[model samples]
Target: MDEPRRNLVRWLLGGGLSASLISFLYPAFKFMNPPDVPEASVNEVSAGKVQDLKPNTGKIVKFGSLPVLLVRTTETEWRAFSAVCTHLNCTVQYKESSHQMWCACHNGLYNLNGQVVSGPPPHPLEAYSVHIRGDEVVISRRA
Candidate 1:
């Protein structure tokens, strides 16, 4: 091939290689550094009815865009806390047999009061006050 034709071919190959590299690296970078999202402000949320959640059972409810885990420890006692784990933000659930919150992602454990019990969680789950109004379960952040 002529000198000009050879130069054109080299340029095209280099451009394609660079584009391929960028395409692969871009997603890896994004996966490592996820974009930040503004959290929605929520003061109170109605979880459900007291009669529906039996003692020693739990349910996940929506508080804005976040998941709130509500547990009924006794017939007269209910607890609510943020379901997101503090370490990696994994969703947590209540383990009825153990009577604790458990994060399946990392085996993080938390008590009914949201205090970290074991595993990789660095902070306790955010606690919410539970109020029973006429048969409805209401959860709200502490003042």
Candidate 2:
């Protein structure tokens, strides 16, 4: 074709190819090195009213972005622990039949004090301090 027309077509093709390459590489680069996001500093969180959980039962509460497990072992006794399993970061639940925290992902077991009891868990669940203020149950990180 004409010389000017050929140059125009070449520029258009080069621009399109660069745009496609950038579109593909941008996401891959982002996925490989994600932005650094600091975790929210949470000192204490109000779980709920004491009456919300019955004796021998457990409830999961959100502490910042993490899940905190609150177990009412008895009418006057309470315990709080991290709900994440140490094995693979799986969420853990209370098993009333066994009176312990159980991670179904690998059958990891933890006692009332958040101590690893059995299974493949490499470390004990983090324990939190439980405070009873009037009718409210508050959970806080230990110093």
Candidate 3:
């Protein structure tokens, strides 16, 4: 076409290409480098039965607004994880004998250590720290 028309077409094409590139790159960048891991409040989470929480059993404990999973291993060690599922952030339930943590919302299953064994979980459940304080079992964030 004429010089004026050709110049206008070239400018439009370049602008469109740049916009497309930025649109694709923006999300990729966000996904690659996540915003940040939020700071979890540090407090003692008391769960029932440091004694009744028998081996291979788990219970849900709360510290302020946070929900944590407390599990008793076969070796009598107390382990803790964030009760929030890694996939959709749903709460998880505990099976005492099988030692498997079950998320009924999507049928997601995790081992006592919070490792996903089945269903659509994207990552292993986050493990925290637990200890015995006074007569209560305390679950807390690891430093």
Candidate 4:
């Protein structure tokens, strides 16, 4: 009888600990999914007509859900950069005449080549590889 009583007690204690452990572990397991990087869709980006973009001006294009700045530095050359700011995750605005990328939230400034020349930005802007397909400008990760 004593053996049976001890066995019952042990079973009850083991079950309680197991349940508690599972409760703690389940949430951890649910939150353990690997981090994911946001990817821009390739199909949504097109040439976006050179005639529409004025030289020395930046036009914001809505490609999928991302905002991309299409800038024409010269009549022959077109460039593209992500609107996302390198510092504090703010969106960056292109300053055409100065060819500097400016973040209004702070005093962060970057050169036309996306280099961090001054301000609080620790890194330069992320450059999107761009190319011309006929009259269309293509912006893509593969570019």
Candidate number of the best lDDT: 2
- All candidates: CA RMSD (Å): 5.9, 5.8, 6.4, 4.2
**lDDT tens per residue, model 3, 11-121:** 999999999999999999989996777777666666765677777777777766777888777655888888898889899988765678888899899987688899999
Instruction: Indicate which candidate wins on TM-score.
Output: 2
What lDDT tens digits, residue by residue, belong to model 1 across residues 56-125?
Answer: 9999999889899999999998989999999899999999889999999999999988999999999999
For model 1, the stretches where C-alpha displacement exceeds 4 angstroms are 1-40
| RMSD score of candidate 1 (Å) | 5.9
Candidate 3 positional error at 125, Å? 0.8
Please provide, for model 2 over 52-103, each residue's C-alpha lDDT reduced to its tens digit, 9 standing for 90 to 100.
9999999899999999899999999999999999999999999999999999
Worst 10 residues of 4 by lDDT: 38-47
Give the better candidate number (1 or 2) by lDDT.
2
After superposing candidate 3, which stretches have Cα over 4 Å from the reference?
1-40
CA error at residue 135 for candidate 4, angstroms = 2.4
Residue 57 CA displacement from its true place in model 2, Å:
0.3
lDDT of 4 by residue, 1-143 (tens): 69999999999999999999999999899899767777754544874777877888887777677677777888988777778777887888878767877888887888888888888988877677678888888877533
Error of 3 at 63 (Å): 2.1
What are the clash counts of all predictions, listed in order? 0, 0, 0, 2
Q: What is candidate 1's CA lDDT for residue 114?
A: 93
RMSD to native, candidate 4: 4.2
Model 2: residues with Cα > 4 Å off, grouped in runs: 1-31
Query: How much does candidate 2 score in TM-score?
Result: 0.78
Tell me the deviation in Å of residue 118 in model 3.
1.4
